[model samples]
Target: MNRIPLRAQALGARLAYALPRPLRRAIAGRPIRIDGQELALDAQLLITLQRLSGAGMVNETPEASRRKLEASERLVSGPPIEPVTVRGLVLGGVPARLYEPAGVGDDAPLLVFYHGGGWVVGSLDSHDNPCRFIAVNAHVKVLSVDYRLAPEHPFPAAVDDAVSAFRHAVAQAADLGVNPDLIAVGGDSAGGNLAAVVSHQQVLAGGPVPAFQLLFYPGTDGTTRRRSRDLFADGFFLTSDQMDWFMDHYMPEQDRRSDPRFSVLLAEDLSGMPPAYVATAGFDPLRDEGEAFADRLAASGVPVVKSRQADLIHGYINFLGVGTRFREALSEATGALRTGLALSGRKGADLNT
Candidate 1:
C-alpha cells in the first residue's frame, strides 16, 4: 500500500499543477527538444522531480521496484476515478478486475486491458486508476487483466493469460454484462505487446478476434533497436538500462526476442487483424517501433489510427492524476475506443469515421 495518504498526495498534485507555466518551466529547466518535438512542460517537470528524487526502477529488485512504483503512483496519479464500480473476477483462470461505470447499459463494450510493467512489475492496483479512467471516459467496461509477470513466470505466461482472458471475456460477455461483438483488447508497453499478439493469435486460429485494439507506446519489435530507443534511451522515465533489466528478466534469451509471440512487428502475416488505435509518445524509446507496428497494420489493410502524442513520453497513460497532457492524450484514445466499439461489427464500415 502507498505510505502517503491519498488525500495529501492528491492535494499536492493539485498544488503542483496550480503553479504558473513560467515558474514550472523554470523549475523543470529548459524545454527538452529531441527529434524535432518538444516535451510537454508537465511531463518535463515530473521527469525533473523524479530525477531530483534520485530514486528509480533501475538496479532495484523487482519486489522493491514494484513497491516503489505502487507508492510513488499514489502521490502523482491523484485519486482513482470514482463512481466506477470495480469488482474482482476470474477470466480463464486469470485474476482480473471489471470496471463498470455507473449508468452504463448491460450490453456495454468491454476493453480487456493488460497493465504495463515491462511484463514484470505492475499489478491490478498499480493500474487501477487508468482502468477506472477508461471505464468512465470511454463509457465502457474495462476488464483489467492481472496476468502473470516475468522473471518468475516469463515469456509466454503473460501472453497466454492475455489471450485466455480475452477469449473468456468474449465467450462470457453476457454474464459479464458486455457485448461480445464489441470487445476490444488493449494494453500499455508490455501489455500492449500482449494485446497485439492476442489479436494475431485469434485471427490465425480462424476464430474469435478482438473488434479493436488500443495500444499505448507498445513494444512492437524487440529484436532490432530503433532510433528512438537510442534518442530517448536515457532520462525519459523509461531508460535503456531499465528496459535491459526488464528484457533480461522477462526473456533472457536474446535470440528468442524476435519470435512473433514477443515481437508482433515481425509477424509474417498481419492482415485480418482488428482495427487498432496505436498511440505512441514522441519522447518514448518505443515510439518508433510502435509507429512501425501501426504502419504495418495500415499496410496490411487494417484500419489503424496511429497517433503520435508529440509532447509525451512512455508510461504517460499511468500519469493521469496530475497532468493535463496525459489526460488529454488518453482522452483521445478513450474516445476512439468508444467510437470503435460503436463501429465494430459493421462489415464494411469506416473505422476512422
Candidate 2:
C-alpha cells in the first residue's frame, strides 16, 4: 500500500484544525442561533455544505444533503478517466451513469451502489465520482442507483425502489454487459442501511441475493441510543443532534422506526446473509451502531471484515481526491471489495449491470 507522506497528513490535519473557532464550533456543534431557539447541528452543517457545494444548490429539503453532496463532489473531481453508461429499466423507470475505468471488459462483477443522504438526499450525480473510482480501482462495473428519497417518499419506498433496481439490474445483466450471479450491493450511511435491507429482502423474496454487501458507517438500529452518540457526537461532522434531525425527517412517524425493513438492526435474524465489509469512522456518532451491527453479523456466522478509520470523520469515502488518507481508505475499501467479489467466484463480470 502507498501511504501518504507525513508532511501532507500533518498539513491536512492542520488545515482541519486551523478553521475559525466559531466556524469549527459550528462544524462540530449545533446551528448558530440568531434568536433564542437552538438551530441544531444538521441545519448548521447543511449551511456549511451549501457554501461548499458552489452553484446548482437545490433549495428543497434540508441543507445537510446538498452541502454533503457538494463537499463530496469537490473532494472527488479530477482529470477525466474511462467512462461507460449502463441503462436499466427498473421500477418502471430508466436509471444509469458513466462507468469510468481501465481494462473493465465484459463479465466483470457488478457492484450495485446506493448513495447516502439520510434516505432523503443524494442522487447519481451527487455520488458520480466515488462510483466511477470504485468501478476503475476495483476493476468492476458499478451500477449506481438513484433510489427515491424520503419526505416525498418514506420508509419502504426507498427499500422498494432499491430492490426493484437491483432486481432489474440482475434480470438484465447480459444487456448491461455483466454476469447476473456476481451482483453485490453497497452504500454509505443511509444507503448502507438500504443495501443491507435490500439484500435481506432479496433473500426472502428468493433468487438474486447479492453475493456480498459493503456497508460504510451504516445507520443500523434506530431504537437504542448508543454511547458513541453522546461521546463523539459533538465535534465530528455527523453529530447526535444531526442524527436526530435526519431521523425526524426520514421516519417522522415513530412506528416506522422499528420496522426491520427500515432499520435492519432491528431484524430478528441476520443469518444466511451475504458476507460483509463494514467500515466505520472513529469520530462519527454512528460508530457504535455500525460496529455493533458488524458484531451481530459475525455472531450470525457470516464472514465479515470491520475497519475503523481512526483519524477520519463521517462521509470520508466521498473525499477520495482531497486527502491522501481518503484515497488510502478508498483503496482499502476497493481491495476488500475485490477480495470479497473474487471469493464468490464471480470475478471479471461487467460490474455496471
Candidate 3:
C-alpha cells in the first residue's frame, strides 16, 4: 500500500469537499470504467469486493464474519507511513488499539472509535488503517475499541463496553496522553450506533459528555422503513437480507429494537447531546437513517455538519491508503473531525484511507 501523495491530493481533497452537493452528484452519476469490472461500480468498492470474494463465509458465526471483515479491511488499506506509532492495551477488560502519530502532544485531542460490522464482526484490526489515517491527518490520538461481539454477548454488552471504555479513557487522560476536554466518540455503521447511544447515555448521566460525535452511516432507526433502505436494499454492497441477518443475530427479539440505546432515532428528549458530524454514503441502505439522525440532532439544538459522500457506497473508508478519489472522501471526513474536535495542527497530511 502506497501512502497517498501529499502535494496534489491535499489540494484535491479540499476541492472535493468544497464542491457543492449537486455538483458532486453530477460528477458521481457519470459512470466510469475499471478494468475487468462492470460499469457504475466505484473502483475502490470493486477492490473491496474482490478481497471479500476470497474470504467466503460458511456461516454467519462471529468467527466467520470476523475473518471476512479482516480480509476486506486488510485488502482495502493502502501502505501507511513507515514506523507509525501504534500501541495496544486492554481498556478495563476490553482490548483496544491506540494510533498515535509521531510527535503528538499530551494535549492532542482524542477520538474513541468503535469498529463497524453490525456489532457482530468487526475488531480493532478491521479498522486499524482508518484510525491511523485519522490520527495522522487530523493530528489527534485515535483509540479504537474492541467490544464483545453479539450472539455471544448480545444487546447491552457492546453498549456497556463502549461506555466503559470512554469513561476509562477520560479517567486516565494524563496516562493516555490526550486532552479530556477535546475527546470525541465516533464509529461507522453499528459502531456509529453504539457511539450515539454512549453520547446519549453520558448526557443523561450528567457526566462528562463527548465533545463531538462522528457518525458514519449510522443505523439510527432500525424499525423505520426509510426509502434508502428499500432503494439500495439489494445492491450497493449492503443488502436488506444481510442487515436482517445481523439484526437477528444481535437482537433476535423484535421488542429489543425499540430500546433507545439500540435504536437511537427512537430516543425521546434528544436535547443536550454533543455536537455531531455525520457522513452518509449515497448508496448505503442506512443513508436515510443517518441523515435523519443529523436532522434530529440539529432540530434538538446541537451543532451539526451533515455530509453526503454521494459518489461512494457503504464502507468506502476502508480504501487502501492511496491517492484514490475514495481516500479523498476519508480525508474530508478527517477534516470534519479535526475542525469539530479543534485538533490544532498543520492539517494536510493526505494520508491513506
Best by lDDT: 1
Rank list by lDDT: 1, 3, 2
> What is the descending TM-score order?
1, 3, 2
Candidate 3, which segments miss by more than 4 Å at Cα?
A: 1-59, 81-83, 321-323, 343-353
| lDDT value for model 2 | 0.72
Q: Against the hidden reference, what TM-scores do the models get?
A: 0.95, 0.78, 0.83
lDDT of 2 by residue, 1-353 (tens): 01544344334434543566576555646544421334333323433442443322233456655764554354344333455454443434736553636676677789989998788767776777778778878888888887777777767778888888888888878776776777899999999998999888887777678989989999998988898788666645666776777788778888668898877887888888898999987667888899998999999999999998765667777654432566677789889998898988644344434
- Worst lDDT 10-window in candidate 3: 344-353
Q: After superposition, how far is residue 294 of candidate 3 from its true place, in Å?
A: 0.3
* Candidate 2: stretches off by over 4 Å: 1-68, 75-91, 98-100, 346-353
TM-score of 3: 0.83
Error of 3 at 76 (Å): 1.6
Q: For this target, which candidate reaches the highest TM-score against the unseen true structure?
A: 1
Better of 2 and 3 by TM-score: 3
- What tens-digit string does per-residue lDDT give for candidate 1 at 1-353? 13556566557666777799888888889988998999999899888765654435553788888877776676666677889998999988999999999999998888999999899888999889999999999999999999998889989898899999999998898899997888999999999999999999999999698989999999988788899999998989898778889998898999999899999999999999999999999999999999999999999999999999999988998888776989999999999998888877565345535
Candidate 1's C-alpha runs over 4 A off are 1-10, 345-353
